[model samples]
Target: MALVAAAVTYLLVPLVRVFALRIGAAPEIRERDVHTVRTPRLGGLAMYAGMLAGLFVASRLEHIGAKLADPRVGDGQTVIALALAGGVIVLTGFLDDWWGMDALIKLGGQIAAAGLLVAFNVTLLWIPLPNGGTVSLDSTLRTIITILVVVVSINAVNFVDGLDGLAAGIVCIAALATFAWTIALTENLEQGRLSVTAAITAILIGMCLGFLPHNFHPAKIFMGDTGAMLIGLLLATSVVTVTGTVNYDIAHREINRFPVVLPILLPLAVMVLPLADLIMAVVRRTSYGKSPFAPDRGHLHHRLLQIGHSHRRTVLIMYAWTFLFAATVVGLSVGGVPLIVFPLVVLFALVVLMMMGLPLWRSGRGGRGSGGSHSARRGPAPGSGPTTEDPSVPGAAASPHAPATTG
Candidate 1:
């Protein structure tokens, strides 16, 4: 299924690019943009198409096909729900990429998409308390929590989509981790069936793998809002699918030995990077008395760029941080590492911090002027392109002088 999605997305991109250009969907360079050319967006459409093809193929498979179609065991409606919900996200992203959208309107679309999932019975059915107790949620509360999860997830991916390949790669890593965590959890529970959650994450990972080549630095195309939000929906669904199946009695055991709520923690850990960026972006803008969705170059990626990393290097650094953090948490969740591994992780973290700060250390007196966080005041680094705001569709408060740009 993953391979099918990859090949389809890979082949469909050029055609999507042409169609975007014909429709004038290619956004012009903006004040906060990283790319120089008017690159066509709506790559999410291709991804969506590829995903559909994958799902269709998956439904015909002998292994997962049985699981998906078994009404009593697995809710086949989830597959339909994912498809319909993805359509909503793609359409919303398409409009934003074409002419931008009002932040509120875009948010409504996200809620609507999430509502589709909840209607299909994809929801958080229970919560595990720390004291080995569990609380089952009524439909109303579950629906609200599920929607919040979907919205927060969509915006988190949107927040991290500041650089080429950043969102796709991060989410791919996340989906991959969820896949591993799901399999481990399922095995531990002795549920021999190929779980819906595992399958969903597999599809997501494949779609991202297919999209990454086009989105990488010096990228040929950008995934834009459509792609970011669609993948976010899928990633969240991967988490929500298994939230109910975790036996609290089993999971709650040895809470001190390993994380008891790994099903929840794994996704949160995977999202820590993007979510952190999202929170900071909101706080930063609100503190300035601007809309929380206002576009700015204060994202974690933007800071990496500001610190004198090349566009490519900045992207690589972000990727490294994401892998380190997610893998560390996953290792803890799975629970077979040597005690020395923790110390090694710390050593790795210190090395990462050193790398993160290396340019500042190397530049000494001269580097001070160009390091990031001061890009707005100092301008771009020597010979570097002018810095720009993110202008993401979720909440890009455009300059009064320029048309709204949700590229």
Candidate 2:
């Protein structure tokens, strides 16, 4: 299913690019943008098509078909809800990509789509207790929580899309981790099987992977709001399906202590990077007496570039941190707080610290020589020099013709 989805997305992207061009869906270079050139951005259409193809394939498989056929469990209904909700976001995003919409209007669309999911019974109705049972949420509370998760997730991904390939790569890492964890649960927990969560995550991974080739640094195209919000909705839906619907009794029997909270913790851990960025953005904006929806270059990735890390290096650093967090959570869940996890964490921290300091170290070393190192003498490599302009603030640099920052 993943391969099929990848192939479909890969084949469709060029076609989508042309369609975006014809429809005037190309985005102007913005202050918050990393790319200098205007790029077509309805690439989410390809991703959505890939997802549909994957679902179609899954529905025809023997084992997966059996699960879909079981109406009592409502897996089929959840899949339909996900598709419908995804369509809403994709349409909303496409509109915004072509002709920017008001922030409040976008928020309204997100709420309506989230409400649609709740209507289809795709909601977090219950949560696992650290003790030996579960706590059920009242319908109103469930609806509220579900809507919050969906909206927050959509915005989280949207906020992180400041750089080429950043949002898609981060979400792909998240979906891969979630897919692995979901597969583990199916194996260990009673009444668990190949689930909608796993299927959707697999498809999500494929879509991101397929899209990355065109969307990476020095990108030929951008996913824009369309792809980011669509994937966010899918991710939130997967979290709700797994965390809210799973029977925790089996988890209680198979594991003890902290592992019992894995269901709740897993989603947060997978998404910790973006969620943390989102929280910090809100607090920072509010503290400055600005609207929370106001755009700025204070994002973690932006800061990384400002601190002398090259664009590719900054993206890699974010990827490393995300992997460390997701892997640690999964390791703890599967291994039950083993001592080795600490050493692994320490090792990762050292690696990150070293990465963060590398440019400074090299600069200091090169300064010792009058002529500078060979690479320095040859001029900074592509995307290795400091950017004079702040990409998030229009006309921040002295020169109007300065090159745009790339990441």
Candidate 3:
């Protein structure tokens, strides 16, 4: 499956680049946008093409083919539903990329796609109780919940795409966590669960891996709404399919027997960042009497930069935080204690806090290069400088157009 995904992505990259160029799908850098330059936004086509190619190849594999042929493996309905729903979301995003669509319309489409999945009998059937018994949610409630998940995940990813590689990186981390949880379950049960989950994850991983080179800092191409929505759909579908498959009783039994909170926690843990960001954004926007979808430069990344962190530093910090949280969740699942894991997580968080505080410390130092940072060009800093040039600094003497300094 991994090989298939890799191959598909390898072939699809150029195709997507060409398609994006042909469509003139380039992102125009705006005031609120981070990039200073325009970049092609064809990554969605690449990702979707990779997904289809990988799935198609995997489906043709003899072992998987046999399974699909058999009605015993739950009727192949889930796979079909996934493909159809993903296609819907991908097309909607693709269209939006071509002719920008309103948030409400996009959201309505997402809900409708999710509703289609529910109609195909792919709804969450059960909920494991905290204590013992299982509670089965009604179809209507399940549909609503499923639709909400799809919409939330789609928008959360869309919101997080401000920084190059940010959204892709987060989704990749979440996918890895979900893949691990699913594989663990399959191993625990000694069943066929791993194949589907692993295959799905491999395709996504390959797509991100293949695209990251072009999507990283100073990105040559932006995934734009198209890539973001495609990824969001994939992520949403993976979570629902994996979690929805867990029978309430089975989850309850596992919880009663051992520490099976891992299964329930895994998906939530993987998605915590995007979910939290979305919730916070909505709350913040609503408080100002603005629509939740209103655009702003107040995302987590923006805050990280607002206080003086460099762009690269801010992105790296977010990645580190994401990795640490994911690691903490994995550690807990691996039988680490609340006593141990909590402390370790806290310790890790403290390190991040210190890193986050470093900018303030630096600012307090007056940009003086306190630790041998070229001795501030041996001049009275900026405003304090004399009419004569600070000959020591490069270009300070030739200041025909000194860059304007923001307070």
Candidate 4:
């Protein structure tokens, strides 16, 4: 399924780029914009198509099909809900990409998408607590919690999309982490070869992998709002599914757990970067008496740049942080690494990375060098470097004349 999704998305991106250019659908460059040209966006549509292809194939395979045939994962409800909700976000994102959208409307789309899943019973059945206790939520609470997760996750991805390959790479790492935990958990429980969370995560991971070649620094295309929100929704769906049918009681008794909260915590730990970014953004925006949706260049990535890190270096740094945090949590949870050595290893790695970046810091402090970033001087290749469809502002537009941003 993953290979299928990756291949399909990889093949579809260039075609989508051409379509975007021919239609003249691109964002206007704005302040803090880095790309020299307003490249075409909506590559997300291609990603969506790729993921759907994977799902289509999975529905037919006897092993995966059997899982999908079960009511919680299959019975046509959960899968259909994911597809329809994803379609809704894709349409909303497409509209935002072509002509921009009100932040409220974009949020509404996210809510509706999440609500669609809840209506189909694709929601958190309960939350696990640290003491091995379970907090069973009522229907009303479940609905509210699920919608909140959807909204937060959507915005988190959108906020982190400032760098080319940044959001995609981060999300891919998250899915990989999630897949690791899910697959391990199911295996520990002797629950066949795959779980719904693991299966969907496989497809999502493939989507990101396929999209990355085109989205990497010196990117050929941007996923825009369409892709960011779509991936966010898919990620939340994967997390939510874990809580639905898993016999937590059995698992609780089954595995030699670490913190007992790891199941509920591991995915969030994997997503710490985006979630932390979202929280900081809200606090930062609101502190200035602005709406939480207000746009600014104070994001974490921006801070890295402010400190003189090159665009590419800043992105790589963020990836390392994400991987370290995620890997440590998973390692401890699965008992794959000694807990005592984990922190020591992380400290050593951080020291090394920080030391290597010292030259960039000194150069940036003196205003003499800024990672020698030439992104502002370089133009996108013909039919590449898509304009960002940003929803950071309440009513951000895709101005064709504006220079392209790092997106």
Candidate 5:
């Protein structure tokens, strides 16, 4: 039944994509923006509308509703809170999409929305210590942390939407991982707990799957801040509701031991790409004495393209990394794999990343010097070619802007 609802919503996203394009919600190629052609930007509305429809169906299903009626059924109220807060955040972002808002204002709205979640008890209160004690935080600290998580996750998704299907693909990978983990850990618990999380995860997966066709390389539409922010908010809220708010401990005593820390880990796994991107963005930004939120071409995806990766190739590389990470965590939990799996996966990813870096290495643009073994051509400076454009800057090309294209 839930699957049926997801399928229904999944089909609806493309139609919405078409509608977005017709409504003048398109992304223009700017100096700071990366793409070449103008693409519709309100892809999030279709996604959210479909997701809401799916959830509504799930909530109304007789069998599903009977199980969810219990207060402990996957913390339905928390999910509701998530949906409500997400609606607000989505609206905030849509407004930004239509009429640009300053970074501080957008951030302020994100923080406030997160604060609302904390009010609903969607938060982490205590962390399990390595030495057997629990680390309990004060309300203020908890609030601050929760707000940061919400805001950061929102922007992280926003940041990664630079390339076609990149953010959606990474998100789909992360959700699959976290969804698998949630089910594995809580399968023996209450009835609908798994179902609710599974339902929401399925909806997210479906929406992304449906949207990707239109969002991939040669994308006809962009998710923009509207889609990106909403998707991020939904992912963040799902993490909180499934990992933090769900009462898995009542059915499995061992889970309660770690409490806060375990929940944190789940969200971290679910948002690995965005979190990594956020940290990298901050490090790169601060290193040059610029505001952390300042727009720049230092994003992970940007660097990948700068090294001669094509748009499609760059998106695929990110997809591979995300899937690899997701598989690692799921393997740890379900395959009953040992800690060694972490190092093994990390090594494999690095090897692949190095191969991806070979082009840059050969071109002498791998962050060292323009002195590698690729065809000797004194091309424009790094990020100077037509391929790399500042998404935030105006007068940029929509497609790959490079001196000579190399797929």
Candidate 6:
């Protein structure tokens, strides 16, 4: 399913790019932007196409498609609702990317889309209790919680989409982790099955991987709000589908030592990085008497650039952190503290340390002539290229501003 979705998404991107150009969806270079070019946005249109293709293919497969045909299971309906909600978000994003909308209006649109999900019975019904029990939510409470989850997840991904491939890569890692956990549960628990959650996640991963080539450092195009918001909606839907509907009692029985808190912790663990960034951005902006929605260069990725990591390295570093965080949490849930897990944890920590220290180490060996001092002094600027002290290093470099190009 992932492979099929990837192929479809990859093939559709060129077409989407052309459409974006025709529709004037290119974004002007901004001070906070790392890309020096006015790249076409609305890449989410291709992602949406790929998602449809993936789901269509899944609907025909015997094993996976069974859930779609089974009237007793709500997975089929959930998939439809997810697609509908996703379409709403993509439209909102497309509009914002093409002509821009006020932040409050965008928020209202997001909430409306979230409400659609609740109306489709995609909201949480019950939560697992730590003492081998379950607590159910009343209709009113469920609606509020569902909307909040959808909104938060949407904004979290949106907030982290500051660099090329950042949001896509992080979400891909998260989706991959989630699929693994879901598959494990399906296998171990008798009541568990391959449902909309697993299918949606697989498609999500494919969409990101397919779009990543164009979105990587020195990007040829951007996903803009369209792609970012779409990805967020899909991710939030998958999390809700799995966390809200999973048989926690069966999960507890199968993995006795698994934390009873896994229902809540699992989603948070998968999304820890973006959530952290989102929370910090809000706090930081509010502290300075600025709107939380106001854009800035103080994002985690921006800080990585500040620390002298090149564009590619900064992206890779973020990927590393995301993988480490997701894997550790998933590992803990699936297997409680296995021997090999500790060594793997140490290795990841060491890798992070090495990446963080690489610039300093190279600078020390090559001296100030290495270009490190120059890049460091260049500081953060919008539309500025990455600063690499070493000329040999391939990083974003400040370039002369070209005349703004329109699609």
- Best candidate according to lDDT: 4
CA lDDT of each prediction against the hidden true structure: 0.71, 0.69, 0.60, 0.71, 0.60, 0.69
Per residue, candidate 2 scores C-alpha lDDT tens digits across 348-394 of 65477457756755665333233433433332223221223434432
**What digit string (tens of lDDT, one per residue) describes model 6 on residues 55-126?**
888888887787655543344476577678888888888888778787877887799889988887777676
Question: Which clashing pairs does model 3 show?
Answer: none
In the range 1-407, model 5's lDDT, one tens digit per residue, is 33553465457657766776676555444554433456566667767776776667667877655444435432446457656776777787677665557777777778777877787766655555534355566879777876777777777777677667788888878777767766766653444455555666767777677677767766666666666776677677666555443554363354433322344555565455656766876776577675665555555676665556666777899888778766766656554444345546556766776686775666565442643222112212222212333344221222221100000
Cα RMSD for candidate 2?
Answer: 5.8
- Report the C-alpha lDDT of model 1 over 1-407, residue by residue, as the tens digit: 88988889989988998898899877666655433576677788889988898888887888777666655322557678888999998899889877778888888899999999888778888766545466788989989999998888888887777677888998988988778877776666566343677778888888899998987866677787889889989988877777644555665553332344556766776677777667776787777777775666666665555555666777787778778877786777677443345446555754774578575547742233433233333433221222344434222222211112222
Better of 1 and 4 by lDDT: 4
User: What's the CA RMSD for each of the models?
Assistant: 5.0, 5.8, 9.2, 5.0, 6.1, 6.2
Ranking by lDDT: 4, 1, 6, 2, 5, 3
Candidate 4's C-alpha runs over 4 A off are 29-34, 74-76, 257-260, 336-407
Model 4 deviation from native, Cα RMSD in Å: 5.0
Query: Candidate 6 clashing pairs?
Result: 31-382, 371-389, 372-389, 386-396
Candidate 4 lDDT tens digits, 1-407: 89999999999999999988787667555653445676778889999998899888887888776776668643446567778899999998888877767777777888888888888888887888655678999989999998987777777777778777888898888888888877777777877634677778999999999999998877788887889889988888888877775777778897654433555665566566666666886686677676666565556665555455666777898888778777767767677443355446556655755575577566555122443333222322222333333345221222212111112
Q: What pairs collide in candidate 4?
A: 28-398, 28-399, 29-402, 29-403, 34-405, 39-386, 39-387, 40-386, 220-385
Using Cα atoms with residue i matched to residue i, what is each candidate's TM-score against the true structure?
Answer: 0.85, 0.83, 0.78, 0.84, 0.78, 0.83
Per-residue lDDT tens digits for candidate 3, residues 1-407, read 65565566556766776777778665443432323455566577777777777777778888755543333222466567667877888787777766667776777677877877787766555555445455567868878877777777777777777666777887887777767766666655655643655667767877777677766776666676677877877777666665444444454444332224454455555566656666776686578776665554445664554455655666678787777776666656545344335446656765775577575666653232443122223311121101122223221221111100100
TM-score of 4: 0.84
Write down the lDDT that model 6 would get: 0.69
Q: Any idea what lDDT model 3 has?
A: 0.60
Residue pairs with colliding backbones in model 2 are 31-391
Q: In model 2, which runs have C-alpha deviations exceeding 4 angstroms?
A: 29-35, 72-75, 338-407
Candidate 5: where are CA atoms >4 Å away?
A: 1-23, 27-35, 66-76, 125-142, 188-192, 243-262, 337-352, 363-407
- C-alpha lDDT (0 to 100) for residue 200 of candidate 3: 70
